[model samples]
Target: MKKLTTLFLGTLLFMNNLFAQDQGKRFYKLPIYGKYFETSQQFHRVDTLKYNTMPASVKKLYTNSAGLFVTFKSNSSELYAKWCVTDKKVGLNLTAIANKGLDVYIKNRAGRWQYAGSKGTVKTCEDGLILEHLDSTEKEFLVYLPLYDETTSLEIGVEEGASFVELPNPFKRNIVVYGSSIVHGASASRPGMAYPALLSRRTGFNFLNFGVSGNARMEKEVVHMLGDINPDVFILDCVPNSSPEQVSERTVYLVSYLREKHPNTPIIMIPSVIRELSYFHQNWNNRNHLQNANWKTEYNKLIAKGGKALYYLDTSSLLGEDHEATTDGTHPSDLGFMRMVEQIEPFVLDVMKKHNIH
Candidate 1:
């Protein structure tokens, strides 16, 4: 019976592929969104030309299209994507779909974005249907690129005669978020479910992700590049990647440098969420405790020195008391990401509102 089931599934997929090819579709280049600088490449977060001295670790991760996406409008019965990623990397803690897959969201008539479809690529490049049997009405789409892999090329496919147009980025103001693997989207079920991505969808604002996996250690060159963006709000969530000593030594410099560059921009600092393993591991628990203390101490010192628009975001309640929010006791799973968004959305919205960022 298992052999028969496998055969049936394989046949179905083959037919689907054949059908997609038989339809004779037209492909158009998908324009990327969430690009902060004009690098030599399209999906890069930084222009390596100017900041040639950035650390090698940061230079490598900056090319991953974590927060990037593409938008378009189509009036077709189906949608397809043909794309390729640079490295096609895989993560032990993260799903391949979230790391190097495509997530599609369509805007309803009410102006709310809804998850419509998703597809994970199996090779360096694959052409497959993302969604079929649509209502054939004109509507907007937002397709989030890979969160951990760099998208080297992408094209959206629609019916040969159908109208398809790439839309301009809807979100105007940028809220830059710089952090560790959590911010880079470690264990999200899909790319769009990451906390910063969720925040962007919920608020209809551009929450640019600068998540660098294990590399967000508050380095001087990284902080300087962040200062160059000069966003409306700056969110620092790098505590997880930095050791307690690193946090103590770098927090002041990180905050002070940004303050010196953009004094009035709201600099929101987020300490690491409680790791479930820390509840049982004394060293991990102690390390996290010390890191939070140091982060808050630096914030207080900056405030004492009249640092304006600096706020410490308390995320102790992020994962809830159940402690089932992580995939590896470190990175948040989809449920954990949802909880994070729910807890974080209100505070973030309030801060942006007060500052009249809308």
Candidate 2:
């Protein structure tokens, strides 16, 4: 009788612990939609509701109550979806849409966001796909389309009919990057190939890419946006377009503004990658040297002012010791991007580790 009672108690305890673990895990439940883009105009059409546009490989389609309208083409093999939510309360939604159905993946701050819970299948309703989470602890979310060969078009949105109860965001470290075209990922083969994408994969944290194609000046408005994000690390790599004086002046104010909100977050200043400048014919050497000098001067000043975590990365040795990894003359090729990743990886890892991200 005593032995039986002890066995029963052990079983009950095990069941109780299992239930507790289940309750602790986060669950996402939301509906999602997919669309295609045929032209720049069509792509802009989906920009309504502050939605961000996907790459051009997908066809053009939009939604307006009646449901989503998608066009089918024989040669098409890509699909994209766009949506925006200023409300940080709700987590991301992942979904799929198609008669033939396609295989896909979703990754979040944990890295490599891939679809969960279901496989490719025809949908009976317009918004038949769903993915959702309420936890704000997650920094970044990603949806990967793995069925790139035969599959096209995917629907992604926050899970529908799910309640969102605000919880504390557990992520402590944030990364903010300021740069020009390459940082914005102008012409990578795919979205995942972008350097930000690569770095996000390795570090598993949230990052804000303030990269503007041909427009990342030391502008006050841009700095305001960066300040709003309130990152843990600020990286300025805008040497592709600014003069040395502009870099020094604008960066000083930007760093100061960020320091107001997050006094401890590190600022990582980078110089331009090595490239040929047919316009100047001096190559990227002169511009790089001048920018480095300016950055060092400002960095030292900030340090002298008792800045605790100001940091710098010498990108001259990043792509290669002799400058061998560019595509056109200014932008990074795939190989160049990989090399850039190698250079910044150490700095990022150290910062994240200090904050206990991994």
Candidate 3:
């Protein structure tokens, strides 16, 4: 009787294995977008060789793949993702999906990018279904990486014999945004919810994110690196991470260095978004007022000194009046990020037009 039972269990296990193997899929590497250096294959925003020179905090956050995505065209009836993330931890205020997950977007027939599906298990590596049971029509797909984790490896899986093609970047030029944690995609539910990513989809521009969390203080080394990129447009939103004194001292130097690098590029400065927690905390309130004031003073000085092609972004309505836009009163929730893109997109488009940034 025992031998009969063991033989029956063995046969069942073998059948299950055969069934899983029959569902095998083929994977293809997708081209990454939004990385600062094209030569980097590690999904890092900046060149890894220079990591030792950057601030320790920046060195860590630059690998988070905050604004990176992969694009491809496929006609498979179903889709899956095989990915490995550097971290498998989630923050108290951040979603596990946002930390180490995948979000997929598909371009509809009307030429609009829409969310399709997402997968998040907070594992070091995972192979899971993203979407299935489609009509097998060829379409462009965009998959956003984790918002707060480093993507060491990523590949899209499709049924065997399905047509798949990696797509090239479709944007015109790079619009580099340098800022703090808000730019680093903190508290966003997914990677694509970051304001820079939102701005990219809305305006059809390649907005590269250089959001160095806790280290966008405009230090000499960091500013030098920014100057080296010489993007078509530069947006500085680092006031939230810098003290009033630092702003007063660093603003001029940072802008001046970049101006000297790319004399014709448009340089815009934005003050920090209003933190809702500041309403009741006197210290927080005072800090906001001072930093913004210092920023305005620096902008005036730059303009007075014949800083042409310089612009200022009005951030009064960046978070709206409801005071419910933030997850922790510091970083924006997805709602807040959407509100910011709505306000910022038009102003940025107008600025680019004036500067002939096509």
Evaluated with lDDT, which candidate comes out highest?
1
RMSD of each: 6.7, 17.6, 3.9
lDDT on C-alpha atoms for all candidate structures: 0.87, 0.49, 0.86
Tens-place lDDT digits, model 3, residues 118-155: 88867888888899998878989989888888889998
- Best candidate, TM-score-wise? 3
lDDT of 2 by residue, 1-358 (tens): 9999999999999999856533423333222222222223321213323333322221111121101112111111222233221111210111122112222333344444433322333332222332333343322233322111122233443322322332222223456667776665533333344566567556655444445555566666556545655555788777667777787887778778878867777777777765544335665567766766787788788888887667777555556654556656566666777888888878777765676655
- Once fitted onto the true fold, the runs of candidate 3 whose alpha carbons sit more than 4 angstroms away are 1-22, 39-41
Q: Write down the RMSD of candidate 2 (Cα, Å).
A: 17.6
- What does candidate 1's lDDT look like per residue over 222-258, in tens digits? 8899989878999999998798899989999999899
- Model 1 off-target regions past 4 Å? 1-23
TM-score of each: 0.92, 0.55, 0.92
> Which is superior by lDDT, 1 or 2?
1
